[model samples]
Target: MRVTVIGAGAVGGALAALLDRAGHEVSVTARGDHAVALTESGLTLDGGFGAHRAGVAVVARVPADTRLVIVATKANDTAAALAGVDVPSGCPVMVLQNGLGGDELVRSVLPGSPVGVGLALFAASLVGPGRVTVTAAAPLVIGGDARSVAVALPVLRAALPERVDVSADIRGAQWTKLVINQVNALPAITGLSVQQTVADDRLRRVLGAAMAETVAVGAALGVSWQAIGPVDAAALRPLQAPGAEGVAAGEELARMLARGMGDVPNPASMLQSIRRGRVTEVDQINGAVAAAGRAAGVATPVSDAIIALVHEVERTAAFVTPADAATRVSTTQD
Candidate 1:
């Protein structure tokens, strides 16, 4: 497969490198120092996917006869990145990005090209100028035209540890991921590491409130969420083992989460974004939920507050470090 990956940052570099190693002709569209580095040193992918360097054609221009174009840029950069890129009319373009509206944006850019959206459950980052770090290994849930899967799936899975699942109801899956991802912004805002944020009872309560608001909004908008207590409990299920058993255990854990008993850690993506001084996708995450709430006539005060705090941080151009977390919390409270 001839694949071109735009945005040679964390996600793009990681995917492009792995696909290149898999015998696919991979090209990464990056700029400036990153492009130069990728051309010279290849891409260093570390962490769960292991440490390896794979050679890929790094170029500024999109190549002709490209089989697939994967857009892994940030949500804000999607429009600018795809502008003027020449893809075949029927060629598949996969959007591997966070938040909603990414597929629509890609469709608008490519017009006749088949556009698919992927919600990546794993965590990855550009730790250096030419290196990508995979913090967690999770599946990439993709929903789009079936024809697009040919190149997208093989290339993506080759790079990732888990296989990609083509979804029938991608929107539902995206919303499910979004509801869970509401906690990601916590690490950025509170200046806490992944484990530290989830360990705090107060932070977990805050996140639980936000998740409840998103679930409510989803319900109001006619999004049917599966009964997600026991069936969905796999990794977090064993956390509360011992005396409880089977369905009873699942129900009990579900009850605890619903009532804000269990704690959860922040996601690495949001933390990395804030730490690197890049804008957080709070507007597209929690802000999207709040917008849905309004359209569905559901009130989402918790989400609204979360969005507001994140927005303020963005507007002020400030970085919330771990040492300043207490001061920020105190100021926001009063």
Candidate 2:
């Protein structure tokens, strides 16, 4: 399979390397030092998937001979990333990204091609320009139109490690992934790794509150809910329990996510963006939930607060203490 991955950052780069390791032809689009590094030394992946290096074609444009396309860019960058790119005919496009609206955006941009969405249950970090470290490992769950799945599933399943599962209800899978992503904000706000944030008593509760709010929004939208790794719908329903039980369930859900990442110091994607002075997808992540909550007449003070804090960090390039983050969220909840 000739797979061209646009936006060769953490997620894209890792998948490219793995596909190359699987003995498939892989090309990735990258820019600046990252592109130079990939061209010079190949793309390097370590940690969870084990150390692997693949000499993939580093290109600015998608190759005409590309058999499959995967747009692994951030949610905010999805539009610009796909802009002006001509995909090969009959090649299905998979928008493997965080948060929401990525597939629709891609479909709108490339109306000729089939577009699907993927939720990476694994966590990876772009430790450097051309290097990606897998902090956690899980399947890449894919879903969308039936035709796109038929064309892309076998190729992807054969190329990637572990399981490359497909979801019948992609929206529910996306919501499940969004619920998992509630761990992202607190880490970005406090400049802490996910495990550290989960271990903090105050911050843990704050994370629980944010996650609970997200689940409420999903329920309001009538999400059927699919499992993302160990996170099943049943595991999350307790998050809707009243008062203290809900809080504990939410915290437990956070812990379940943390345990999946193992002992590696996973810095979650949002913090990675902040540390690099780049814009984050908080608007699409937490902000998306908040907006939906308002539309559903469900209050999302905690998610709203987290979104504000993430934006503040983006502006100041500074991280707040856990105490400060927790207090701000608590005050809003009050």
Candidate 3:
């Protein structure tokens, strides 16, 4: 398969490397310093998995021969990154992003091609120019079937260590992922890893409340989203101790929280946005919840507060300490 990946940051870099190693012709679209680095030196993969270098074509613009186009750019860069890409009339584009709007945005931009939503369970970071670190092993959930499963699945399965589940309901899966993402903000404030934040008894309370709020909105919007990964509250409780009786019941939460933080040196995506002076995905994540809350007549004061705080950090371009964030999140329920 010939694959054109638009964003060569963490998600795009990892996907390009994996696909290239799987014997597909992978061309990455990058610009300026990142493109120069990839041209001079191949991409670097580091973390729990042993690092391997694979040869891939680097280009400043998308060519005419792209078969499957994967848009893995940040939520904010979706429009501009897509503006340059030239896709065939029938080529399928999968949006692997962090929030709720990828499918619609792509459809609005490129109406002819089939657009699908992808839920990335794995954790990856662009450690440096032309380098990506795989922090945790999580499945990449895909929706839509315009492309052949026999052709694309084999390539995806061979490249990624995590299993790929082709979902009939991609929106539901995204909502489920969003339910888990509510805690992403918490880790930034608490200064803890994903597992550590879930393991802490007090932090677990804060996260649980946040997720419950998201779930309320999800239910109202007719989207079914249950937290599936170890990121869920049920998975976090056992890591604390059996005595933590108030948390949800689940066996995998403990094991998930027990796993070592893979290779995430940078903060989670939302936290990174706050640090980078970019607008966080609050509008898509918690803000989406708040919007749904309004339609469904559900009160989402907690989500509203988190959205405001993160937006303030986005506008100010100052490092909002995790402790301060934790204090804000902790007080929301009261």
Candidate 4:
């Protein structure tokens, strides 16, 4: 299969390497120094799966004979990344991004193409130009039109790891990922790895509050939540209701997150963005939840405070302590 990855960031680069290793013809579109580096040195992937260097075709323009197009650009860059690229009619385009609305955005771009939505649960980060580190590996869920899934499955299976699955309810899966992503801003604001952030009891309560608010908003919007990996969205409903039982359920949810994470010091994408001096995706992740909550008349004070703190840190280029985040979370009124 001939694949074209639209972004050479973490997920894009990692998938490109995996595909190339799987013996597919892979080309990646990148910009600035990253493009130059990929062209000169190829792609280097390191960490848990060992090291691999693949000489993938690095191009600024989308290649013509590409069998599949993978949109791996950041949520905010999705529009600009695909603006000029011409995708063939009826070709399958898979959007591998965080947060929501990525599939619809891709559909808007290539109306003739089948847009498949993917929720990538793994952790990969761009540690250097033309290099990415895979900290964790998890299943990639592809869902949408049946024809599109048929087109994307073989190519993705060939290029990606063995944990890829197709779903009929992709939107529900996406909402599930979004609810999980609400915890991402906490790590970014506090400058801690995801595991460490979730391990702290105070921070875990904050995460619970944010997640509970997200689940509420999602419910109000008529969105059904599906379980992503081991985190059961149905089990989390108890956290949304007010009571001592709900508090206990929230604590259990936090513990579940901690256990799922183990001791891996993997940083969330938003934290990685701050470390790279790039604008974090708090707006699309936690901020999206808060926005939906407002429209649905559900309060999202926890998520709102986290968004504010993350943006402030982004502006000042300073690290926020976990203690500071706890203080803000405590004072935030639901």
Candidate 5:
């Protein structure tokens, strides 16, 4: 299979390397020094999924005969990322991003192509230009329009490690991932690894409130929750209670997810974006929760607070202390 991957950041870089290692013809589009590094030295993969170097075709433009196109850019970059890539009609484009509605965004971009939206359940970071490290290895989930998913699923299963799952309801899977993304906010705020943030009592409590609120939003909207990693509708049942027990359960789940990522100091993708001085996707991840809550007439004060804090960091380019962020999150609940 000839695969063309745009946005050679962490997810894109890891996918390109893995697919190339699986003996597929892989070409990646990247700009700036990252592209230069990939061109000069190839891609380096290490950590959770083992180490390998995949020498793939690196280019600034998509090839005409590309069999598959994978866009792993940040959610906000979805439109711009597809700007110049003239995708072949009917070619499957699997968009891997966080938050909700990724497939719809792509559908609007490449209407003629079969489009499936996806997310890497495992955590892979672009540690450096041309380098990707998988701190946590878990299944990658893909689903959307039937034709698009059919085109992308088998090829992904063959090339990827851990696993590749096809969700009949990608929105449900995304909602589950969205609940888990409660972890991404504090890590971005405190400049801490996910483990470090989960270990803080105040910060953990704040996130717990946010998670419960998110579940409320999902339930109000009647979203069917799918399991992504350790999260599923059943696992989130405790959060429906609206009390300490629910918050505790949410915290425990967050801890389990952090433990799954290992002790490699995963700063998480949002924090990585903050460090790079780029915009974080807190809008799509956390802000999306608040927006849905407003429309559904549910209260999401906690995650809404987190969104404000994330924006503060983006504006000032400085992370907050766990205590300070906790204070704000708790106050919002009050």
Candidate 6:
């Protein structure tokens, strides 16, 4: 398979290295110093998968005759990332991004091509130029047209260490992932790792409130949320209720977060973005939830507050600390 992975950041870097190691002809598109490093020394992947390097073609432009195109850019940068690539008509393009609407964007860009959407259920971070650290491992869900799945599944399974499941209802899978990603903004706003943020009772309450709102909005939009990996969206509905059930739901959510964290203290992607002085993806994550809530006539006070605080932090170059953001979020709930 001739694979071109756009956005040679954490997710794309790891995928490129793994696919190259799996004997596929892999090419990665990156920018700046990372592009230079990849072209010069190849890509290095470290962590539980062990250190491995593979020689892959790194380019600023998407090469011709590419069989599989994996769009791994950040949600906000998806448009710019695909703008340069001239995708072959009928080629399968897989969108591996957080939140929603990425698949549609790819479909719009490459009309007549089979577009598959995937939820990357693992944690990976770019440690340095041309290097990525895979801190956690989980199944990657790819869902779309059957033809697209047939084109993507075998090669993706061989390249990734985790299992690959083809979903009949990819939108449901996406909604499930969106629900799980609601906590990502909390870590960015509070300057804490996901584990720390979920472990705090107060913070967990806020997260629970936001996630409940997301579920309500999804319901209003007629999306039947399904389970993504180990996260059962249906089970989380209790968090929306008042009294003891909601408390139990919060505790259950915390326990699930702890289990997901496992032994890896990996920071959420938004937290990493803030640390790098890059704009966070709060708009696509929490902002998406709030937008849906408004359309559904559901109040999303918690999500709205998180969005405002994250934007403020980004605008002021993180003048607000995590503790201060948490205080603001709490006050909003009141």
Clashing pairs in 1: 198-264
203-305: candidate 6 lDDT, tens digit per residue = 7777776776677778788887777887776576776576446655755776696677677777888888888788888998888888888888978887899
Candidate 3 achieves a global lDDT of: 0.69
TM-score of each predicted structure versus truth: 0.82, 0.97, 0.84, 0.94, 0.97, 0.94
Which portions of model 4 show Cα errors greater than 4 Å? 243-248
Model 5 residue 251 lDDT?
88
In candidate 2, where is summed lDDT lowest over 10 consecutive residues?
Answer: 82-91
Question: Looking at model 6, which ten-residue stretch has the lowest summed lDDT?
Answer: 317-326
Better lDDT candidate (1, 4)? 4
Per-residue lDDT for 146 in model 2?
Answer: 78
The candidate that achieves the highest lDDT relative to the unseen native structure: 2
- Between prediction 1 and prediction 2, the one with superior lDDT is 2
Number of backbone collisions per candidate: 1, 0, 3, 0, 0, 1
RMSD of 2: 1.1
lDDT of each: 0.68, 0.88, 0.69, 0.81, 0.86, 0.81
* lDDT (tens digit, per residue) of candidate 3 on 1-334: 7888888777888889888877888888876676888888988787644477857788766667777788888776888887856777777787888878877888888888878777777777776778888887677878765563434566678888778878776677777787767767654444456666666665565566666666666666777543445453343333333222322422233224336454354357776555444566677878777888899998887687778676666666554555566577667755
**Two-way TM-score contest, 2 vs 6, winner:** 2
Question: On residues 1-334, what C-alpha lDDT tens digit does candidate 2 reach at each position?
Answer: 7889998899898889888988889999888899999999999999788889889998777889897899999999987877766677667898898888889998888887888888988889999978999888788999997777877788878767779888999999999999999888888898999999999999999988878888888998999989888888999999988777888899998988888778989899999999989999899899889889999999989888999999999999989999999998899989
| Window of ten residues with lowest summed lDDT in model 4 | 243-252
Model 5 ranges off by over 4 Å: none
> Over 4 Å off in model 2, which ranges?
none
Model 2 has an lDDT value of 0.88
The residue ranges of model 6 lying beyond 4 angstroms of the native Cα positions read 319-322
